[model samples]
Target: MRTNGDLNNTSAAREVARIDIDAAHSYRSLAISEAEDDATIRKSYRPFLLSPEITSTDWISKLELSTVVKLAEEDLHKTGERLKVLVLYGSLRERSYSRLLAFEASRILFRLGCDVRVFDPTGLPMKDDVQHNQPKVQELRDLGRLERRPCLGLCRATWESHCRLQKPNRLDPPLRRLRRPTQGRTLAIAQVSGGSQSFNAVNSLRLLGRWMRMFVIPNQSSVPMAYTQFTDERLADPVEGGSRMIPSGNRMRIVDCMEEFVKYTILMRPHFALFGDRCSEREERVEKERKATEKARKEAEEKRVE
Candidate 1:
């Protein structure tokens, strides 16, 4: 959560730096809560100077156990290596609940024989900050390039004049040019702190993924009152649930979503897309040429009639 200053310096005023404003649409900070916050507040920040310890649970619920077994049955084509995944989280608070959830998901994924990597969003300038080839950007790109052709991130979504993911994010299109790393890859979303359990952010991501030609998986997860959903090391059990229950409420949704992602990846492996979006771009060019040719024919026909 320490976006600007050293984690050791807890008292420093090293808050997030000046954000580059997006010119297309003007934003005004309306309701900045000393106690509550929203995405519109471009500079809204919380100080989480400590890293959270992700707890592991060996006790699997019957629901989770059954889901895993069913997934295994569907994964007859186990490609022999752990599936690789990349997780991105939004917010810089040292104890970002979303980060905790992402980490918890990573632990579960790792236990499920996944080769997982979680990106620290620190120094990740907004997509509008610079070109897509910037060091941090390239690192993200490369991660999506290798053996694992999918990129998944934990993101904070917002609702303003309309619905969209958090501003100044990595998925900005102008910076990426033609080589979109997410193109032809698998994607899924998990949101946190949806006071109303809104899936707006994930829905926006789904649209953007399709625009980039990504094979975004249909399943996604969103946690309402996300804080109530986790503890120091793992997801929290329902506050009102019976005794001896697992501390995982909405956490199972994450499992369900990821399980679906794995199965779809295997099922679509052979006919997977080629990255860089060249194929889509090529289609656009062909469409334009067809229109132009039709116009020429129409003009010729008009001349002959005259």
Candidate 2:
């Protein structure tokens, strides 16, 4: 039903043909949805937003769609309001490419009809350096609560906040890290640097995403030698030539990853998320902890009586 090119375009695979720059759509602001904010998102620090990741010569040229692309396109037809997405980036540089990539993903997601929120990982203390009471730490925790099912997004940077969500192994409170960063929500990760590889940050994110029980989208982006691909105002398409996974001229990876994420969030929300059985592992662990607490309480009572 789909051609190899279409498959390549959709999946997280690298290799294959190069898209003609002349034919590629000029980067445009996401105007595909009209959803407004339900909750107020006032912040003290201003977020940096780059309009066009790359300038386009024409406004109408397009990239060939993958089947996955069609799925993402289909999500736009839903009748409800836009999905809320929170994007987190990992860098703190003056001219951070990861930050720029966050802007790029946000714009595309905006075009796809999602109410996106980008979290700047600045001023937040390390996961170990500060207690959870700090305002910034509290902000991260409050934002990460998955009860509302908003996409808790992240870019390149420290995993301190994500790590906080991890409950200690056996002795750790099973429910202490209550917010399920990955469960019942949509998430995506992206990174960019002047160098040609920054997979470590994203790879770490994947580990955290899984540990947090999140449904992380399969496709991801890591723009290496990023300076070559981005101009002052826009992120230029990758030039053809690179390893298998990291394709050159792979600007579309961001779109592919985000589209898949939106598709999963919308399509799978009901089927995969809503009707799920509580994890047996968690239940068993909770029961064990309850027993331990009861035993400890009884022992303390006996000592007091003695």
Candidate 3:
């Protein structure tokens, strides 16, 4: 009894309804499968993604997360630790004098029994939008994360003087953030200048250090006529036959300052390591105990067989 127009309308409605139902079912299935895949991936890679290194070969194949957490807790209880110090130089010139000063500082730290690392700012892109994944940038981040040390940034005033005409305050935020030298870490400024112009460089460095909220040592050194002071081997040249050069005496003073810096660093390190509770020595002891227990059990089983 229905007309042709009525029949066509009904047919069109049925077709649209069917399409909607099919689309919903398809989407539901795809979502379920995607969730399952994600769970599988997480299960497969979770351990490696967490620890990243299997430090000990003797760990059980199927350790529960709770057990791992307990061991980690125990490790943190056993040993006192110290903070790491990262040293950075703020010059990119070929044969940079500031870098040389940093090297001399590092040697002093090594003598004082503190862990130290140096960062080269050469090729570090100016802190901007496009320079995220650069190797040097990543390296800086990794050191910032792992070293857990106070930072020291060294820059030469002579270089700053030359660049002032081009960029008045260039090495401010980027180097400051990159260094992240905490208040507990000492930042010693060494300004290498030409002739009597050393005072200008030291004052400028002091202002920058103050803005960064760093613990600046006012006992800064200015190496006047820096180029002629070093030998081909980079050692201080003797100004006279019987006495050391002015540069050599200055280097010795830096070493003395570095010794005090290292003492402060060592004092700060234990507190830094305490928060994380990571102790290598404790882990080693636990491992040793586990091995002894396994050996004893094996020997007892062999005797039972005999």
Candidate 4:
């Protein structure tokens, strides 16, 4: 039952006895005897010994099995339960129509039982080396690294943000990290347009989301003549120059679409819940196996010596 590493080393027998001994006195005596009789052996089998290079087919097979075991343990620990959504807005205008649209969308989602976070692009540095290490940028990076739930970003189409073309092979670090797909999280994009130009913005946002591997929802809103649509209070007044107002029918359509989008976002993907039971069970199993295997190998070696 001796393990391969221990088979060639005679001193491993006493070392194994020291490990397996239960009685305090017996353990003390064996430990002292081994330490006195085998200083070199103990040094060779130090606590920080490097694992042998795995080369044999059997070793490779065992490694693969261990990997599978690790993955299974990880999967069992993963629970599908809660969802987190992050919203990213591309516009930073003083009275940005896009930001207003984002806020409205957030409200809709909040009412529908989704945890929503919004990122303001105002202080976000342009994709460059100088700003990469900035604290705010790092914060953005950390948000993207969230392991438990997937984040969703909402960007508006504007000349300053969405409509502009990104350089080839040049990626913003935050965007790059956020785009990685996880088990339970999803990304959604919506484009808010000022007027008929929203059609173009919707297309731009779709392309942006697609490039990032986010699930692009076709349900997009383009507030034609968006400036006239909002009142000083930021509510949809939809009336401009004290003359024309967006038809109540069109306003209702926008509201309804927003509601549907919120619903679809929550129901779209299952959230990954943390599984404590599976994690504990797997840990216990690994420990039990390690102890048992070590015990059996030690006992077999002791019997051979006797």
lDDT agreement with native, every candidate = 0.52, 0.53, 0.47, 0.45
Model 4 weakest lDDT span, ten residues long: 54-63
lDDT of 3 at 130: 70
Worst 10 residues of 3 by lDDT: 24-33
Q: What is the lDDT of residue 202 in candidate 3?
A: 60
lDDT of 1 by residue, 1-306 (tens): 667767677677677876444332121111122344333321322221112221222332222434443443344335543455666666677566667666555555544444456665676676564455667676656655634444432222222113445643543443245245445566666766536677776777677667766677878777776656644434434332111213465767776776676666555554555445377789999999999999999999999999
* Off by more than 4 A, model 4: 1-82, 148-173, 181-185, 234-254, 271-306
Using lDDT as the measure, the top candidate is 2
Q: How many angstroms is residue 6 displaced in model 4 relative to the true structure, after the best TM-score fit?
A: 82
How many clashes in each structure? 10, 11, 4, 8
In Å, residue 298's CA in model 4 sits off its true spot by 25
Mind giving the per-residue lDDT tens digits that candidate 4 earns over 95-183?
76656556555543433333455665656766765776777677666556655434533323232234443221122456665664422
List TM-scores for all candidates, in order. 0.57, 0.60, 0.49, 0.49
Per-residue alpha-carbon lDDT of model 3 for 1-306, expressed as tens digits?
Answer: 665567556656644432222332221100112233346433532211112122111121111223222222233244332224566666777676666666555544432323345665656766675766777777666555425433332322223354231122334445456543433344566666544434666676667666654556657666666665544544422322111223466656565555445444334444654433448868988999999999999999999999
Ranking by TM-score: 2, 1, 4, 3
Report the C-alpha displacement of residue 256, candidate 3, in angstroms: 2.8
How large an RMSD does model 1 have?
20.0
Two-way lDDT contest, 2 vs 3, winner: 2
Off by over 4 Å in 1: 1-63, 66-78, 129-133, 146-164, 168-181, 232-249, 273-306
Can you write out model 2's per-residue Cα lDDT over 95-166, one digit (the tens) per residue? 666666676666556555566676666666654633657766666555555665454343322222222321
- Model 2 TM-score, all chains together: 0.60
